[model samples]
Target: MSEIVRKESFKHVSYLWDDDEAAKLAGDEVALLIYRSNLLGADLRLTNYGGGNTSCKAYAKDPLTGKEVEVMWVKGSGGDLGTLKKSGLAALYVERLRNLKNVYRGIEHEDEMVELFNHSIYDLASKAPSIDTPLHGFLPFKHIDHLHPDAAIAIAAAKDGKKITKELFNGTIGWVEWQRPGFDLGLKLKQCLDENPGIRGIMLGSHGLFTWGDTAYESYINTLEVIETCATYIEEHYGKTRPVFGGNKIESLPWEKRKEQAAALAPILRGFCSSERHMVGHFTDDERVLEFINSNDLERLAPMGTSCPDHFLRTKISPLVLDLAPDEDLSDTSNIKARLVPAFEAYRALYTTYYETCKHPNSPAIRDKNPVIILYPGVGLFSFSKDKQTARVAAEFYINAINVMKGAEAISEYTSLPRQEAFNIEYWLLEEAKLQRMPKPKALSGKIALITGSAGGIGKAIAVKFAEEGAVVIVNDNDEARLAKANEEFGKQFGKDVYITAKLDVTKDEDIQAAFDAGNIAFGGIDIVVNCAGLSISKPIEEHTDKDWDLLYDVLVKGQFKVTQAAVAIMRKQAIGGDVLNIVSKNALVSGPNNAGYGSAKAAQLHLSRLNAAELGADKIRVNVVNPDAVISDSKIWEGAWAEGRAKAYGITVEELPAFYAKRTLLNEIILPEDIANACFVFVGGLLNKSTGNVLNVDGGVAMAFVR
Candidate 1:
């Protein structure tokens, strides 16, 4: 079956070319040059909505007076390439931009430095240079373009972006990880150029694409061709899954009505930012828009933080995940406005609290809370800026970000850096100054994770997953033999450093706290959790006693909650975000028969996760769920008399149980422990930093039985 793939999926640094034509391009024709810039600009596949920038050096007679001066016609910092006219471009002394990156060694005063950079630009446009001007300056080539291309970034965002880029670029291009995209990027790029004098292009992981040439057209054409290659590569490897938009569910509104809705929502959203007057882009991509609008959890899952680092200086992290429907436009902007002001205020409060919690005693002062982006349902996304350009850039970046998010969801899961980690990236001066930086989400080092019930199957898989990814794993189980078996297996498979086993009844308070304390002592702090220790009691409501309900609650719901509460104490004390994963069941959502106590307890577990999420969000604690179905593990109670009894009671043969279960899902497959482990990884790792109160269905679509 043909899968749905992102339209523009590719690697960025593949544009490195070094032929005779590239070696001698000073005399390239002007029309050719214009075409080149436009083609490079048209690489919206790699660079949509002018997200990337390009510059070329030229000697021109002053239009106002008749004096010749050499300057760079750089794409204006915030204009969309889709409609970037020549007149919209800015002119600054190339020598000055280069000197700024080169001569300015270590300027401490930000204001003074801004002033010095301004002095370098003789033109009175007063427009700020692209934050990446230093990157352009440091590159040896005369023609340069930098873009946050979707195609290129698709590869860059991968865990193996560097390895992929190396395979793609081989010896011709260089690669960097995602870094803060200004002076830091420039400095890193400067070093790269020095080290690889023959390097023709640079690919920044998790950021976007960069290409340069001696002439404008060469750089542009090379960027396009390379992006195309990367796109083909992605299509071949990760062939996309085409999730259809089941559409025409709602009536389409006329343009006049749409305009009215846009106007109504604009003013209130404008209040979130300093921009008084705003421009709103109304889109009818309702079917696609509503997918996210309705998915409260997706909002929680998305990196809703700034689309990129440059956006952070303007918008703090991201706008509140707007709660809305895809096709339903916000009819009352005023009401949303009322809701948003408080939300922004809350965001600011949380931001301040986070700073207090995480900042060192002698750290630099944190910046102010200035909102830059605001998301609205059915209306696409809004970028708020004092100028039309910044607002437009904001909108474009947001749209691209949403697309990337959508694509990421179809894959495994898309994650972002943790809030505190992002804060460090946003504020670290040394981190901020390197041009060749690719900012990685922090690794799982210096962190600990506890997996309850890990001695068996699902929990065991999750424990191994965490350990493989560098986190110290604490495996918990009530059964000493099973726990020891897990410890032995992990030690033999991955070595002793990866796994540690302890016996504990998750329901016991002392056991819960002791587990956490031991984990803290072992791994410095508890950062992740996988609560897979729930007892599944297969009994119909009539047959189930109150005692059965209580036991289910104690083991399935309260036990997980207590363990999480204990871990949270350590996590809060350390001031780092903590993640808790409740391994519930598809039976929580869907049921045939004989799952009363189990299902009810699982329902309670879901509620518990959400409550803790809301309560502990301020403490940087995240709580979510992994709903697994029909697992073949030591924890699979169906193997016991009760499960067989349920099958017989329901008039189903034991041989038909798995198939009977498989028919319920859109995808017919067994729900494996590794499947649960993958979803767990998203929750614990940097990817799902902002994700809380989420229910990830590891049930192979079986839960459709409930919704249907």
Candidate 2:
């Protein structure tokens, strides 16, 4: 006879709830619901960022009839429970929502079901309901909470999950097998409750847990109780002899060293993943990551499946593993690329085979056949996506999955939904429609941009514009105070993570190299480089000293070359071409008196841009120049002595000098910093993807500088 397992009690488990705190939450049910949802989301062990949802059944007065009616306030579609607000919940009439099932014919598709669910809303002002509304509606409870808690999923995904669940809950909790969430799953939940009338909750096998009560506190406490019980069971059974890799700790590389190593290999991985679409890479090496990557069974267990079924949408069914030896030197770029290229090809071939073998007749066309997560033996894990944020999100899910797998394997073997079932969730019509409904991203959504002299004036304006269009920005300037102010301003408008500030003097090759390396580490690689750093020196040829001539050339010409050289090396390795925009003056094309030092340097820089365009065109790198005559807004170049000299030459006061230059153009309009920013956007945003070796005049109408 088999030994009987004792049911574990959760008397020692701690919770975040306090009766005093609960009573002080605005004295309303919706506020309580939001609080409960946030409390659950705060603990990643309880729920992921946007994975779980909570709902409460309450009474609200109908605005039309002035009568109280039963309503369910559920988390709205696409709302993150971590930052949930009152506006994030949709209120629907209980009877109206229940009646949705009657209208659903047996032949209705997922899209048709979503439409019916939306029509069940009691108020037109409420947001759209979540896809799982019927699951909450059919259950006979006043308060319901559903979450994909890691501990609960660890139990639910075991090979003998039914046996383990009965032992832990003493048969007081009902169990339902895995089913795609829809009207059918709702009916199954109702059936489970009917069969086990005394059960407090139902555990959906390989999915999640559902608990309910008459009050929000009751439901939340019940959820914690069940989660605690599962955790205790895993502890008692698997906590003692948990498997470890070789039973010895591996001396892991430091984070800074890992980043340095990643800098050399990330571009090669990005190059392999790039096709018609570009891919950005992000690296992670937390404690949990180290445990998983250093495990003895990593190659066998990691590729089985995700911790939960919904994760398939973001992380795919499995991750691709690479053989990065511990003793190998990662700083060698050539050796790293030679190893990574073949691995990438093999992973793609495997994915193609999986897609052909598992896709259903109704499945949507296959997405890009590249892996989102890659595991390196010694270094760490790298996640790829269209942008940095999404890449980080994928990494978070993978980390959570690693933890859950460890817990499940401690008791029994881990199991996941089969390939066909995973494919059903991945290609669901309603989920696909959500992607379609999202507003189109800006033209440069996933690209990285580096701008020099971005503390003020045209450089600052261009930095703001690129951020608005969805590019991650690297703001560089020699002035520390001005750069700090720019950082604060950009952080307020966009997010703090949208841009990084660095002190750079473009004249030094070392400074140029360090700036590019910082950007490559912060983001994956550099995609756009704009050289707008310059100073003005207006004097006659004979009056100008050699010092003045060298200073002008060092900034305008030599500095531009150093920055471009560093950018091209990174771009060439990425093999995904980039854009280079140099902010020149109209003086480059049309010379003026007493402008010998400035004009000669500007002209040399202009020709250098043309030269880069000629040499880098075969690699798909585009180089261009934007020449503006006068832009006095926040202009440091036109201040003090330089302004007085230019004004005296124009036979006007300093204040009228701008107007004097404006009147010379055919349009007679003064150029602003935004005008030059717009022209840079045009070339860098791929509007002229095929055009290179070009100069655009932003001087309102400079006929002499205009290209035929």
Candidate 3:
């Protein structure tokens, strides 16, 4: 799609409608509705993830009546506008929906309206209608947008919102007092249009904005014009009194220092938040968040909470604002932890009280008491959720709230939704039902794994297996090219936000720390570590030099030690018992000629795993080993000399090595990298979870190398 750039004097927001994209879906009202929504939703300034609803009314052939009738299409419950699809839209008979008001008893009976909405659906198989459906269906216009754009919401959240609305648009835009969205609110909008008779749009109090036109394009333009006007007004007022939020109270740390603090703090925060269920973390040091956190009014504004219901729902009623005084040292980890522990406990207590205060007879059971978002004065915001995307989106939503607060405080006093009102929406019976319908989480749903040498071979197999079980993985490798390839393949398989990449050498302490830091910044911290990075050099003892021995020990033994040592520090800080699975070898136990260096290194790795198991048992950190005899398939260790050396040691050609190794096993099976990965998973996958210091021989029944 292309745009004929508008000559309007508007700044602050763009007019992104592309004629070519619209033309492709010309005459398809639903597609155009989706197009308009994508453009509005593409920018966070316009709306947030799954925040608002958009709709269009058009004539459609009623299958039952075989006659054309007006039908309304709206974003389905829990659908994000940016990714709205035909399947994500609910289609309903407009007249039937409007007629639902006839059966509506009152606001108390609004929860029952959904069953009536189900009956009004034009197609029974259409996506379920959201609670916001009435706000669209009851409207008189052919097209409408209910957006929580920051500019629009800034005005809506202001203390004098109604008066400001009246003066800003000069009667073109009307205002409706704050009311929970339902049939009653929809009817109030209808009443406003009736009473005024000529208002172009309406501003929803403590909520969002409504703009409509006969066509989708026209509606899109009206929305843009309304938002730009609000932006212009806010900026004009903001200029006179810049440095809003009552001016800055604390100075922002240097850019790198802020991120360093965030990285160091994320795992601890994630562990505290994961008390009930393991939670993934997302960190953002974006300047906007910094501006707000460093502001003097942060203490006053943060607890009042966000005004918009969308922002309130994802971010919770309030954030856990860490008490980091301006004079406090950001690098003092112990002092930070001391304050955080008590602060977290207090937040939980507050939430319990809030739930008790707002409970109705039929309210849903109290949910997890952890706050979704956390803020610190010198550092940035960290959001926690079951997976990375939700965590990231929750962080994004709070930033949207920050923007809303910025504009509101710049112009007028900002206010929050009534406590009871926010609670009703959060714990509403309908919202509970939505939560109930969610699919069951995977076994390792919130566990994060960091797999060394995951760019290929057995390491990659372990990574894929872990990710498949709902664990987010940090795929680690020293090879840049291989890491990129692994990243691309993993991304294709698992989509974004579930996995991250770390390029590092396990042999170097700096590299190991950087890897863990990357994991902390990306996913809080890892709960599983697979020490799978290794290579082989099979040679006669007489021919083996000091270089060969050092090289072998450095990669196979020392590398695993360094990575696990770093992982233990993180696991200890998180206080989350974790899994450390070492990929050893049958060579460690079985005697063979021309294998002195490689075999001794494997023995060191095996002993280290056992020692780690004994030493770390009190911390509940499990260390186990998997010994696979021959995992030559697609392995970098078996490319040239290693393969030839192993083949020669067995008195066979490279092509015959597989068959020979298989025949040597009692079960006569050729072991693969995946078999080794399966053994690794068994140690950590809750099957053999209680048994640490264990050895699993995945050599297809090679009795000579059996653990016993």
Candidate 4:
């Protein structure tokens, strides 16, 4: 008989709270309670600047009358949860906030929203109630605590997230798909409660978990218990591995030396910070950081993925792994600037492509196409904030997230929330409002994407795919009439705001950058890049020429490298994660006749894709290759002369080519642009978040099937 394997239960954490002190609060205690809330904000991991929010509901008597008045002391807008003051927690009529939820769905006017906002009894000094007032009011519980717990999210990001959730919650939980968190979320929760009357808490998909209790401590305990349990489960099942990003330990360094390093790198901060108040700097251990610098695989893996979307608010996607000689001195900043500029340009190009592909005409323009913060090998992270506090808060969030991602990746693949889903949440008004209430320490809005070779076929398909998700796409091709017609057809279904046309050569760097710059200037920054620009020439090696090889390399490999390099630079400056997808042929891996030059060029492109992925990983720049075959189109292989020659060589009629290719695959069907487009979006978006330096084959199972 097989031995019975027993699964383990989750461990819970006890929050240290002074119960007697908390329960003894009277009118005089309001000041102290508010003060305590502010103290918690200093721990940026929990509440980065104005991330996690807190509130207290109480009944107080009117000054002039004996009648009881019910009010909620909630954190105010623009107040960091860590450094909040007694006055920072606004006193608003609880009845009014509850009332707003009833009317929120029906009201569509901005004026009414502004009017309702003004009615609250906000502290004369602080900002409005934290954006979570609606969520708080809608909850039946008196006190509520919400946080984007990194541990919980790390568990939630696994391949078996659903199974884990079932294990953790058992049957007494409610799961809600990610929705704009506001009045809509409130209404949805109410419906969920109506269905599952006995549920203890809810988990927001692609977001985080929610728990509450009658008292503050109970609520806090509930939140911690959920996180602790998830963390323990993850540690046990996944088997905990030490963080790949290294530990928080810092070696002793002289204050003067640290200051000197900070002084040398301050200019990079100046461009993105846009102000001095938000500037903060730190230096890392010389030996440990260089360990990553020394290893090629480590350099490639570091920036391969993000811990969470929240990281964008700080370190963006990745950091720069500086070039250092084995015996060279550690304090050199000479090579830093040279690397920084080109990295920023590459980031911009990617950012532009992402923005163009994702946004429609109605979407807002881009903003801050440069990274607001950065981390360098042998140096700690640096960020520009509206104020010093902001910089620290942003850095803290990213640092923890980066650590979590590295740790998570060690156990299994580091996955990301799907790109379309991330876009939906990012653009959702309710979520943005919550961010706005906190001064939005990190800026990620208004980015564009420009997809080239997009006039019908895979290029056009990818362009439309990005548009539906959230990006303003600039479609380009050599065929003007075809380009115009494809745009019109796509526009009729998606809308006119979906596409812009550019008749230009993909081989020219200036042409690509100019198109990218125009798009970025129109928006603010570019966020994603998909290189579907390619062509195939099928002639025996003897018939191929130096000119043919050069043209093939220029289109398939060199063009993509140039475009990707430029895009990475912009994204680095913007401090945002950018994606690059190269459309290479499956023939590179498994070859066919008279296609040596084409296959060889594609192989070179595929290698460049990985090299780029390795070099740019630290900048939050990801590069991957897509290998597709049997994509029926007007390529040289399917045309008149080539088809006739191929038919004669194979001793089969030209009409049999489609069936021959299709039957060669496990699934007998001609691959379409739409199929390739689906894979393209999945990679660019967050579906393959933890994937880079990966070669994904969307060739209809051809990799597994053998040809007769």
TM-scores of the candidates in the order shown = 0.44, 0.91, 0.97, 0.49
Question: What TM-score number comes out for model 2?
Answer: 0.91
Using TM-score as the measure, the top candidate is 3
**RMSD in Å for model 2:** 4.7
Estimate every model's Cα lDDT from 0 to 1. 0.62, 0.81, 0.88, 0.59
- Please give the ranking of all candidate structures by lDDT, highest first, separated by commas: 3, 2, 1, 4
Candidate 1: tens digits of C-alpha lDDT, residues 516-558 = 6555333334568778886666766688888888898889888
Off by over 4 Å in 3: 7-10, 239-242, 325-335
Flag regions of model 1 displaced more than 4 Å.
1-35, 38-50, 58-73, 76-102, 107-131, 182-184, 235-288, 294-297, 310-316, 323-345, 351-393, 406-708
Pick the winner on TM-score between candidates 2 and 4.
2
- Give the alpha carbon lDDT tens digit for every residue of 240-352 in model 2: 66554223235557777766666666676777767647766677777778777777768777778784865667788888887776445766667778887787788788777
Q: What's model 1's lDDT at 258?
A: 43
Per-residue lDDT over 131-174 for candidate 3, one digit per residue giving the tens place of the 0 to 100 score: 88998887888889999999999999999888888999988998
Q: Who wins the lDDT comparison?
A: 3
Q: State how far residue 323 of model 3 sits from its true place (Å).
A: 1.9
Q: 1 or 3, which is superior by TM-score?
A: 3
Which parts of model 4 are misplaced by more than 4 Å?
Answer: 1-14, 26-45, 61-70, 106-127, 237-280, 284-310, 317-336, 359-365, 377-380, 406-413, 418-708
